[model samples]
Target: MLIGLEIKNFAIVSNLSTEWHSGMTAITGETGAGKSIAIDALSLCLGERAEASAVRPGTDKAEVSAQFDLSNLPLAHAFLEENMLNNDDNECLLRRVVCKNGRSKSYINGSPVTAAQLKELGQYLISIHGQHAHQHLLKAEHQLQLLDAYAGHHNLVNAVSQRYKQFADLQKEFKQLEQQQQQQAAQKQLLEYQVAELDEFALQADEFEQIEAEHYKLSNSQTILQVCQRELQHLYENDEQNACSILQHSAQQFTELAQYDESLASVATLLSEAAVQVEEASREVRNYTEQADLDPQRLTEVENRLSGAMDLARKHHIKPQELVGFHQTIAQELESISNNSSRLEQLEGEIEHALEDYQNASEQLSASRHQYANTLNGLISESMANLSMENGVFEIALTAQNDRAPNSLGFDNVSFLVSTNPGQPLQPLAKVASGGELSRISLAIQVIIAQKVTTPTLIFDEVDVGISGPTAAAVGKLLRQLGKSTQVICVTHLPQVASSAHQQFFVAKEIADGETFTHMLALNKDGRVNEIARLLGGDNISKTAKANAKELIKAHG
Candidate 1:
């Protein structure tokens, strides 16, 4: 419940602080007394838009702060906990500051927050009915929403939404795939030709390297043979002074010397090893010199193959090494085209399944709505009669536009119908209900749905406008009754309503220091009497009006 409100430099309210009780708090003042100004200040805490003009003429900024005792507002508490916004006190503070520059900031529990967060948290703490709130009930969309809330069918509605979303997603995917398939079908022949060319090459990872190595040997064979010939002539073909003959002769001399001296024995072993290596090297060189032959045909074949692969890579805008990955990509595209018909068949079946799920959920929701609609109509009709519409008839007409495409809310179109007079035929509430009648209707519906509203505080801004006499009294009584379960706040001009408040505040303008200001004062019994009497007899207080005010308070008390 809202515990208090403080306003500073806001509009005509230079500064005002007012405490509120649990039950109905009726706010009353003379016309232009800034009655709604209080509500406007509260609106800021509720995340309503602010303007620079809201600031007092000489002030730099305007501020509005609200306090709530969340001991009973579990929904609000849970929201705070879930969002990690709670301050651990079970008491929440919301503040809004609007600057003359049109910039605004909000704070929750003294922590900085965005305006949107305030609004989200506000939904669970306070529900303020603007003066024109009743006008909304006439719309079909609003009607459906209210009906759903009253029915407590949120889970069922969510199921329908989930199913509808699935169907929509599947339909979207199918369309995209089908469009792509049609595009690919046009390129089918091109893809087939490309794949055939690649298949002929039949690329092997190791084959490229091997072919290049063999090609190098064939291409440079002439140069290799000349170098080998030079080496062999110097080492073995030098007439009688060849390397083999010298090493052999040297080794035999060392062996003969080693027989005469011990130090020559080591030198003899070294020369013998040198003679064997020289002879082997001479034999291999002669063999290579004999077999060195260039083959142009093999080299040409390898060069053509490499050039072809390079040209393909260039056409694909890729490096020669990237051909493998590109080949795999093209293969997949070809496979997709081949398997497309079966894929389309699979998508069609999946779409059907999604549609079936949505249909089942929507049907279930519709059934529940129909059952609850009758009971809701009967209750509102009774409330309407109690609020002075003697022959009022309230009905919820559910029409199924079944052939319409699937939607998140289902296939039903809800309309609120009303017949304010006996001879009148039931018609759309928007067309038939007068402004006063709409107010009454709105009040009746709100009262009926109060139990379903999770918000702990309900505020009505002159909801009794265009109503008087017994009807005003009944509206007050109903509001007071609602206040018993949840905190109710109403701004009213009627003495009947003001007299019924468990707590009453009078808004009045005062002048001091050459500046005008609006202020609120909580009314005691005598203050209530004077205020009620003033409401009855204008600025003049009369004895009869005072007596009437007393009787009104007595009856309610």
Candidate 2:
């Protein structure tokens, strides 16, 4: 249940803080006095969308915060724990801030959260019924939702919806795969031919680089031989002043001088090493000239191989090195297309199973709807009688649709049917009921549904509109009855409703320093009587009106 509310610069309210109580608390005021301001601020705390206009005329922002006692709300407690927002054992605080630039922020237990998260948690805390809630009855989808809510079998409804979604998603995938299969035959054939050509070549990784090296060496063989012969002559093969003989003579002369000085011995050793190195180098040159091949036929074979590789690379619009990876990619694509038929068969089996699951769940949901529809009809009919529609008949029509495709709402079209007058045939709510009758019926449904709701707080913001006199009193009594098990807060202009509450709050606006402010005062007995009298007789409270207000409060008390 809601324990406290604090509002700062929100709408016409400037820093209003109040603690709430259990049971039915009536909020009453003259029109334009902002009686619904409290409810509006509470809604912001519950994560409703906020706007800049919600702030006071000159304020930078608006802030609304609410404190809830979660002692009786196990669901809300679990939600806080699950979201890591739990603090202070049995209390939960929700806050919302709206800045002048239209930016909004939400907080739970002082931890920042998204507005969506706030809404998710709000569902477990309170159920608010607005003044225009009845207008939603005209929508078919809302009618179905009401029926489902009344059934109180959320698990079953959720199962049906999930199964339908799975079946539809599978059907969509199946269609897309079928379309792809139809378009892939030609593509598969073309890829097969191209892959066969590449397969015949059988290119190996890095083989092209080795081939290019071999081709370059073979093409320049003559020039390489000339250079090698010229170097050999200069180093060793030349008969006139060859390097080997020169080095040998120089080593002998240095050996002779080594006897005089030790440094000359080192120089003789270096000359001898040079002669040996030149001799070894000449042997290597002769070995290469002997082994180097100069065949034209082998050169033609290598040239043809290199040309073939280049032609294939150009045809594929890639470098020769890239052919290997490209070949693997096309081969994989071919394999996948070849396997599509098997995959298509697998999808068919899965889709058939999904459809069976959907049918079973929807069938069970339809059965449950029928089972609860009768009970709901009886309860609503009873409530309608109490709301001054003694002859009104209410029915929940659950029409099964066998041919329609599976849908999230199951295969039943739920409608609210009513007969407002005697001897009148039952017709759809929008087609048959007048504005007044619809209001009464809406209230009846809300009352019936509220019995099954487990939320600790239920707010009714002028849901008693278009009702008066005995009907207004009846509305008040019903709300009081609801307060027995749940906290009920109603904002109304009806004196009877105000008198019916365990606590009364009178809202009135005052002007001070050229600014208007709305105040909500929790009325004591005398204050309650005066507020009720004002409601009964407007701004001028006559003696007769005060007497009547007192009598009404006494009777209800």
Candidate 3:
């Protein structure tokens, strides 16, 4: 519950601190007594948006802080634990500061938090039902949500939502697969022809390089052969001056000298070995010269084979060595095309199974919602009658949509209809009720669902508007009953409603030294009577009105 609130430089509230108690508390004063300003300050602590205009004159900033005792609220503790913002003291403090430059900051448990985090925590702590709450009742979506909450179908709704998301994902994947198959089919015949043509060539991995080398050798064969012939003629082709004849004469001279000295014998042996090696080399050169061939046809064939390989490489944007890998890839693609029909059939089977699962989940969800809708219509009809709508008819109209499966909520579209008079046709809630009637309807629904709501604090901002006499009394009684389980703070103008409060506060505007400010004071027993008397008689508090206020309090007591 909201235990305390502090405000400074916020609107006409320069400085104020208000302490709240359990059960129903009423804030009452004359019109424009800064009653709404107090609520606005509380709103700031509840994570409502703030602006510089909310700051009082001559102040650079405005601040609002609220303290909540979170010892009993497990949800709040869980949220704090999830955010790593847990406090050891079992209390939570929320503060907001708005600067004159239009900047605002929020803090929880003395740690700075983003505005979104503050709002999330605020939702779990307090529920403020203002004049605008009546507007929400006019929306069929809100009504549907309230009914779902009462029926306790949150888990069922989540199950349906999960299945819907799965179905959508599978549908997307199927479409992408179909598109890929279509594109692959269009290129099927072309890829087959290319693969067959490349296979027919029977290209080897190193064949291209070998053919280029052979082509170069054949092109220079004549020059190489002429050079070899000249060298062989100098070494062995000349008569008497040839290398073999010269080496033979040198060996004969060395053999004659070897008889005169021992050193000459070793020199004669080396000359003989050299002569043998030179003669062998001369014979091998003569044999190579005779066998050399310069065939133009073989050279042309080698050149044509190399050119074809190079052209294929360039056309495929690959190196000559990569032709083998290209051929392998084409073969794999051809195989895949041959087996596409089987693969497509498998995908179709999977899709059908997924659709069947989704339909089962959707049908179950729709049936549950139909049951929930009937109960919801009955509950609202009962609540409206209790709120003094004698001839009002409340209903939930469920319309089925085609093909589209259930969503997170259900497949049925729910709309709330109501008739204010017996003979009138039932229409949408927004078109049927006046502002005052809408407020009572909202209060009835809130009272009916208050047991299901887990919020620690519930604030009703003049929900008693446009009610009087016994109806006002009944509204006050209902609020008192709601306060038995939750902390309820009501801002009301009716004396009967104010008199029903377990605690009462008065908001009054004061002008001190030419400065206007607002103050809130918790009223005691006598003070409560005086405030109630004021509300009873307006600006004039008479002795007779005070007596009437006392009688009203006595009657309720």
- Identify the candidate with maximal TM-score: 1
lDDT of 1 by residue, 226-268 (tens): 8888887777778867777788788889889988897998888
Q: lDDT per prediction?
A: 0.87, 0.90, 0.81
lDDT of 2 by residue, 1-557 (tens): 89899999999999898888999999998899999999999888888888889999998999999998888777887888898888977888899999998899999999999998888989988899998988998788998888888888899999998998898898888888788888998999999998999899877888788888999999999999999899999889889978998999999999999888878999999999999999999999989998998999989988988888888899989998888888899999998987888888998999989988988898899899899889989998888888899998999898888778888888898889999889999999999988877887898898778888788899999988888998888888988999988899999989888899999888889999999999988899999999999989988999999999999889876
**For all candidates, what are the clash counts?**
0, 0, 0
lDDT (10s digit) by residue, model 3, range 1-557: 88889999998989899888789898898788877676788788777888889889889999999999886898888989999899988789999999998799999998999888888898888888886777787776787677777667777767767877776776676677677778888688888888887888767878877888898899899998988888887777787587767877888898898788767877778777877877788789888878877788898888888888888889789998788789889889888876666766776777677667667776776677779778767777777776788787888787766476535555667777889799999888788888777777788777777667788888888877877877677788888778888998999999988888889899998899999988899999899888899888877889998998888777667
Query: What would the TM-scores of all predictions be?
Result: 0.90, 0.83, 0.81
Candidate 1 accuracy as TM-score: 0.90
Compared with the true structure, the alpha-carbon lDDT of candidate 1 equals 0.87
Higher-lDDT candidate of 1 and 3: 1
Query: Which has the higher lDDT value, candidate number 2 or candidate number 3?
Result: 2
> Of the pair 1 and 2, which is ahead by TM-score?
1
Estimate the overall C-alpha local distance difference test score of candidate 2.
0.90
lDDT of 3 at 361: 70
Clashing pairs in 1: none
Q: Candidate 1: where is the Cα deviation over 4 Å?
A: 181-192, 220-241, 254-271, 283-300, 317-322, 332-345
